[model samples]
Target: MALDVQRNWDVCMAENLERVTKESDQPKDKKDARETTRAEKPKIWKSEPVYLPDEIIIQILEYVSRFHESQYTLASCCLLSRQWYSAAVPMLYASPYLYGKNFDPFQAVMIPSRNLHVRDSPLASLVKILDLRGLVHQASRRITARLLGRTKGNLEAFIAPQASFGTNSFAALAKCHQLRILDLSLVSESPPLFELLKTVSRLDNLTTFRLPRSSGFSTDVNPALITWPRRLENLALSGGIDAHFMHGIVALPSTLRSLTIEHCPSAKGFALMHMLRAAVRPLAHLETLKLANLPRLSGSACDNVLFILPGLTRLSISVDYITPALFDFDVSSHREAIECHYPTLPHAESLPTRHQWTDGKQCELRTLELTNSGNPGVEDKVSPIDIVIALDEGALPNLRQVRVDKTLLWQASATAADVDALADALKEAAVQRGEDESTSTGVWTF
Candidate 1:
């Protein structure tokens, strides 16, 4: 009976081992499916996007466009959707900051194909400012002309390239009636003065015009024939304009507000003074005058500036052309000479009568900027004490701000007291004028 029980137990143990082996050999995927089936899985809900109004999107984009590096962000936004592209494209092309690497693609888009029949690019009209001053050899005359032709409809400001702009570009320039600022200061070779003036005369909307630094006002054209834009307000003259052309301008527009003269290799003190007396001073609205980098002017050449332009409110001149005597209250001789000619001056209707002139004291000058134009030993030309004495003497009653270059060393320990005195004087002046601290009169150095 014990032997029979042992055999039965062995047989049962073999069967149990076989059953466990079969269970283990079954496919693993089926077991996993069974285990997963026992648990509940979460359902994914597909929802529609919230619609935003076009006006709201545009307002958001306008806020983003205020960043300095917003061009890249705007370009990225163009790829989002049709609404985004339409809103971002105008802001992206309105003021394209062109450089060497990206100029080719810009030109391609501006002038899509060589063949004229190809549809004109709708992107062309969106450009408002086409500044090519950064490009050196990337553009040609033909390309500049074509670009101008494409963008002339709404081009408000154009900064010509250094080498590519020429007379060929004038035809398209004449058609840019909407152009407001034309800056050719970086141009290496100026186009013909006659053609340029003639082309620009038609732009009634032009307000600011800067002549090229390389402009050689050769005597081929008569200065009398040069007609300035009627609405021109700001004019910067540079380059090789000689005394004859400088003094021969028939009449500066009455709308001129600011005048800048610099880098004139041929300008002399007498010629400039004559031009100011004859052409510039008569303007009723002339307020700001800037002179710098004039090679021929002496240290005292501009001493009588405050005496000449009695109505001028702002003056920016290099220390190389001025002295402390600029603020002298005794302009008896200058007054006598100017009084003799004031009646005969053009635009006499606008000139304050001889009695209206300040009695040898200029009180209208509000801001003065003294720069260093490569002059040695210029630190001692004008000092803080000089300005303080002038203020005490009541020469510059309305003088609000004075800016000096670092070369003057006004910040040195030797002049610390003088600098403080100047600041205090300005603060007192500001208080007298009832101005707040933010707009207070002060001496600032750069």
Candidate 2:
């Protein structure tokens, strides 16, 4: 070892001497000055490692991967090196928007039976959002279950496909305690409602849930039979929900903040009114209520809404359900006026009083949306004149935006003269009150 070391040192010194002798052969004093300059000059090319720390490099690549169209950038990053690939691979698979052409490839990757040693698969744990909304004829129910089984521990939001989601899928889904949102509204052939509810209620972290769209029921919902998850906040029910469920006190947990009921053919005005007065009114924190495409809800259906939920801020219901009574500023003082002028119930006075009406309270409604544009209930629906008069009389004083269909617009109404007169009165009232005008006294749609 010593002899080899001495030989290598001798070779290096000999090369150094030959180079110095060549430099000295060109003028002695100049060579000495040149050698001193070379020794003092800083080396521009660095020989030490020039790279970021693993943690910082990972963070930078993860940030770059967040852009919607940066898949190409992420793909390039994965090819960079083993460290880069490890950091970038997780982001690439975390939230897969699997649809159309890519569904097959993804299914192959997630299926445990097809791949060996999936028990400790890091790819399965990395997936957080698995949305298969575009699926139709591409997959089967068992495949969905397999996918769920692999991702159960970490899956937070899962939008099940419109088809091929069945009982097998729920077996895996019920175990996903970390789930937050499950939207199965588009399912056509769904599992039995009772079993479905029972399965999902076990999800401890579920917050937002959407029921199947085809869910109008023949009988009322049994609140006692159901165990609602306490963390749930947003719920959407289908048009098939039974009238008995709407009329009777249905099981709406107090945790709910937003509710949507649409395409309910069996829900009559009286049933809906009963629902708001009984089931919904008790929810203190309720803020957004949407009722749309409900054909059976006829004639001033939501007239008594303010009396039910005074704290409601955003409302979307059918046009026929709304009336001048809803906007009566002196509604607190004129209970008789509502009974006499209601368009739907001319004999409201004669009907049995199912609800113990509350003292008429001011609504916190800021946005009012009117749906069912094609219903064409010109005479029965709340008119623009009613809105103008209501605004002028200081009803819904805090209202800011009103949305309705283009058909509801009075831009070319044959009876525009009446609405115009009412609009002018509302403008004058706004000016008198020193408030900003425009609570949808202009062009609007739902």
Among these predicted structures, which one has the highest TM-score?
A: 1
lDDT per residue, candidate 1, 10-120, as tens digits?
999999999989878989998678779866566666897677888988898899888878889899989988998999999999998899999999999999976656768
Write one digit per residue (lDDT tens) for candidate 2, span 221-264.
Answer: 56456777789899988746766666554568899899898766
| Candidate 2 minimal-lDDT segment of 10 residues | 351-360
- Model 1 clash count equals 0
lDDT of 2 at 445: 45
User: After TM-score superposition, what is the CA distance of residue 402 in candidate 2 from its true location, in Å?
Assistant: 2.2
Residue 445 lDDT in model 1?
Answer: 92
Model 1, residue 195: distance off in Å is 1.6
